[model samples]
Target: MTEGFLSSEEYDEQAHRLYDVGDYDGALEMLKEGLALYPNAVELCVGLGYARLAREEFAWARRAFERAMVLDPAHEDAMVGMGEALLRLGHRIEALRLFHRVEQMGFDDDIELMLTMGRALYRDGLYTQARDVFGRAVAARPDSAEAVASLGYALHRLGDDVGSGRQVRRALRIDPDLHEARIYLGHLLYDRGDWEGSLREFERVPPVEHWDALAVWRILELKRALWHMESGDARLAPWEDRLRALEELDDPIDRLLAEIESEVAEKDGLALDPSQLELFSGRAEGGREHRVRSPDGHVYRGSWSAIVRQMRDAAGFGHEPLSAFMRRMAERWHEQSGVDVPFRDPEVFLRAAVEYRLMFLEDGPD
Candidate 1:
């Protein structure tokens, strides 16, 4: 009876667009306005729950899911959303119980439900399980670029670098604008020691979307590394300061990152040439050895692989997990070479190591 009548489906569709683009507030406003016109719409309740989850309002999210379930007792999305909200609320046991119950009830056919569960697992640091769930989601909906990217990230988390890279590339091939795939691909190249390639991907990433909350922080780190190693002081200072202000990372060698950033700031027009920036470049193959002199006048001499081994042995990561290994290596890089590793842990750093060796240890070139 107003300017225009929007059906419940129309309202829900409009809300979906807002939610998909990281505009939770806009989505909520649209959903509420539509719900006022169609108070009995169960789908609108479900959409409200999802938008709340994206905003990290777990309590409200749980209540919204509960409302959706009340409206349609056997709604699969409602059940999955409830479980997800519980997981976010730190009720892992209750969430798992609900998940198992839903599976037993055979109501898990919705691909979105599976995607939501997979992301919850990923956030909980259960990467192996996340990979499995994402695999299922991809199998159910092969065209979902986000599912493919999530699976790739899970594989990366499990230290299957080749598999991770392949999955991420597959996602990119499907949807070139999928930011998660590009971010993963970027770090994958970085792992193999392709700084230029890594820089390219990281720079191309758009603003962090709601689906991936950590993208901005990851980009900041990557850019900071690139600017510090390739550009001079003026360029690096802003990125370095921005990263420092976040206080999100707990790297033991933060002082070293700060020091490197400062070094770039102190330099004039230019500071390093390619030969001097060997650490960032992956040209250490072909019987080429380089002597890297640290900022403190300490010198390490070796081929890239030799240096990696020396650093690995020094960090004592032979028996430890990849994340621990990378963290140790990052600390060593800060301590010895005075550079940020661009990864908060070894798993991410290992991706960068794929193209080239990342090390500061000095042994004779292999």
Candidate 2:
């Protein structure tokens, strides 16, 4: 060892502090330096992989975890991280192999491992499985607001709204500032027509990103609600500039739209739905068994969950054009009856969407 050099223990303390403060790049740098001295350190390797994962450099993350696995083949953390990397890279079968290998090792009893497993399942869009995993996480860590919130989000995604809503409210009661819970609760209230409660929860969200999703969508939806209730129109004036600020800060909606368009462009002239969606069960052209036939010969190819997600995608990206007709509708609604309109109402919005060509939304089947 170099004279007067800091020990690996000292380096790890510094790296841990950097990681805790949301400096994944700095953490990676620290880990690389630490590993230069302790080449075989499994902790440093796993930490390096996670830091890379935070930055979304999935290949680097996989390599780092792979190195850790080479150092200690049976390290649960290394195996889990490797699975997560492969999952994110769209190697689902390979990822599942690693995940199941860990499961077979009987590591499910570990609360921390369950949490990690739950997150991997959630990322893979296996909502039911994720819900079960997170439920186990909640059982193992009753006091953890995060675990409760995870189960709540998974349940909501799985369409168990009643159970999901109860868990989310419980999570909020336990910790008011939990933004993921706040976001999920806001969506639930919006869906149930509790505009006031929905707005309150959305307003409570700090104007930033958390849990891998930005808060911009909530703000856009809030603006949509205000637009629908013109008696609530006073709120809209301020939101215009607020929306502009967020638009300037990050154009996540446009980016998301571009991703969708790029997905189609990549399918070699076939106008397939975005990869995230699988709305169409079976197609005559594909010759897959007809699980359920589309009403028309042509069909959309995306998941039901993706369609629900497109609601937010529409509310976020389609707000400008939809606003023109939406405002007119709201005004007429108020003139005829004094009651203000609710924007997120599925029926009301669906009617308007039939006419609006908002990203896979239209009056006619595509």
Q: What C-alpha lDDT do the candidate models reach, one value each?
A: 0.64, 0.64
Lowest summed lDDT window (length 10), candidate 2: 289-298
TM-score of 2: 0.61
Q: Which candidate has the highest TM-score of all?
A: 2
Model 1, CA-based lDDT = 0.64
Error of 2 at 316 (Å): 13
Model 2 C-alpha lDDT per residue in residues 97-146, reported as the tens digit of each score: 88778878888667778788787777566678788878877876777787
TM-scores of the models, in the given order? 0.53, 0.61
lDDT of 2 at 229: 47
